[model samples]
Target: MQMSWHRRMLAAATVAAALSISALWVAPAQPSARNGTYFYMVMYRGGRASGPVESEMTLTCFPEGGNHPDPGGACMALREVGGDFGRLKIAHADCTMEYSPVTIKVLGKWRDQRIKFIRIYPNRCLVAAMSDWVLNFP
Candidate 1:
């Protein structure tokens, strides 16, 4: 009877893990994901480890709107770099050499092009250093 209970628990755990993995697949399948100038961003803590999501927000450049605190500012920042995350430049002056570790996943369309980028930073400050307007939520 104990063996049966253990097996049942294992099966439940496996199913939950599978669901977590599926959400992190980084695929652009939904209609919202393919929309114009859309960006779905998620921040994760724990240094490149995909354990749990810390925060997330959606930014739409075409119309400049989402849950982002400053949609207009973020859109302007993106325009400065032509909607290229790789070209995102540092706007801040200073940051520590902390090893707290933070990971960010961004996916969606920049105008007509499909965009996908995932990066792990030494700390949250670095992420903001890359781009405060586009990366900061609060």
Candidate 2:
């Protein structure tokens, strides 16, 4: 006896549905994509102890959040300067002028533009004074 055309079509549809469901279940899950700006901040010493020191983090802004511990404060600081690191101003406080030699690097994308910022500060105290606690890599 031959299988009816209607029965064959129904069987094919059922198999297709099953395959589709199984494919959904078998495929690996993925992490949600991050939108807005992404930044990498690093602070390190120079000379004999030329290695990472103090702090380091991944900072995200605009939508405002990231792997950084103080995301809210960092994001707010960035916003205050219109995302321009150079424009960040120090608060009214005294800071020592001693020389220690530390380097800071901020590499990332912001507002669809690539950012590469590197600066050498005399010490952590000077870095804190100059950066207004923005970037939060300290």
Candidate 3:
């Protein structure tokens, strides 16, 4: 059976649309929390996720590795509070009158638990002030 050109084009279009829709429905794979390895993707942006990204890094703990410069220091900071960001101690820092707001986002699995954190700081200085070093991705 010979198919017309128009019919072949229609079939291709349908397949393309189906693939696009399915891609939208697909979710990324989540890491297991029992591996004793904590991985976090940290992002610093001018606003929300849609905003321009200023800095980003991959931080992995429990072996203290990843693209992060001071992964050991960063992991130590997290360990101080048992991977609890809320309990992190903030250090004092000086800054100018600049008002560049930086939005930080963290997502990962931490020691048998899932971690998702997001906060907007008035400037980069405040993020540096956080002794936790979790948000200090450079």
Candidate 4:
């Protein structure tokens, strides 16, 4: 059957609209229970003459309700990347934190270790766990 270009375009547009609406109506993926801000330190081996270098990272999380005014209430996730560490995933629940043994590839050879919501301040949070990385958003 031969459909006019206008008809085809209309069909495509309808499908697109339906997909968009479905996406809007569908609930967001349930964030891990362990969520909040966290700080992490990473150490890398240095050359014979140089000592091991240490890097600092922070992770923070926000719950469905929104940002927690207190650091203890904030939520976040963390992951590690590159080198021998591979990729590590971590999350924070309340005051405690949890980690994932599995690692994933990110960018080139650099693997990342992720840590979420370890609690830094009251209501404030840290999101990413990469050295010097800070969480500015609420």
lDDT of each: 0.80, 0.72, 0.73, 0.33
* Order by lDDT, highest first: 1, 3, 2, 4
lDDT of 3 by residue, 24-69 (tens): 7896543334465566654556767546778877777877777887
Judge candidate 1 at residue 94 and give its lDDT: 75
Tens digit of lDDT per residue, candidate 2, span 20-69?
99999998542122444778778888632347576777777766666776
Count: clashes, candidate 2: 0
Q: What is candidate 1's local distance difference test score?
A: 0.80
Best by TM-score: 1
> Which numbered prediction scores highest in lDDT against the true structure?
1
Model 4 misplaced regions, further than 4 Å: 33-65, 70-138
Overall local distance difference test of candidate 3: 0.73
Instruction: Name the runs in model 2 displaced over 4 angstroms.
Output: 1-34, 47-54
lDDT of 1 by residue, 1-138 (tens): 356888999999999999988877965444344457888898998766478888898888767787888889888989888788878878764788878878888887887888888888787778877875588845
Model 1 spans with C-alpha error above 4 angstroms: 1-35
After superposition, candidate 3 runs with Cα above 4 Å error: 1-36
How would you encode candidate 4's per-residue C-alpha lDDT over 58-95 as one tens digit per residue? Answer: 22333223232332322222232322221334334343
Q: Which pairs in model 1 have colliding backbones?
A: none
lDDT of 4: 0.33
Worst 10 residues of 4 by lDDT: 101-110
**Model 2 — TM-score against the truth?**
0.63
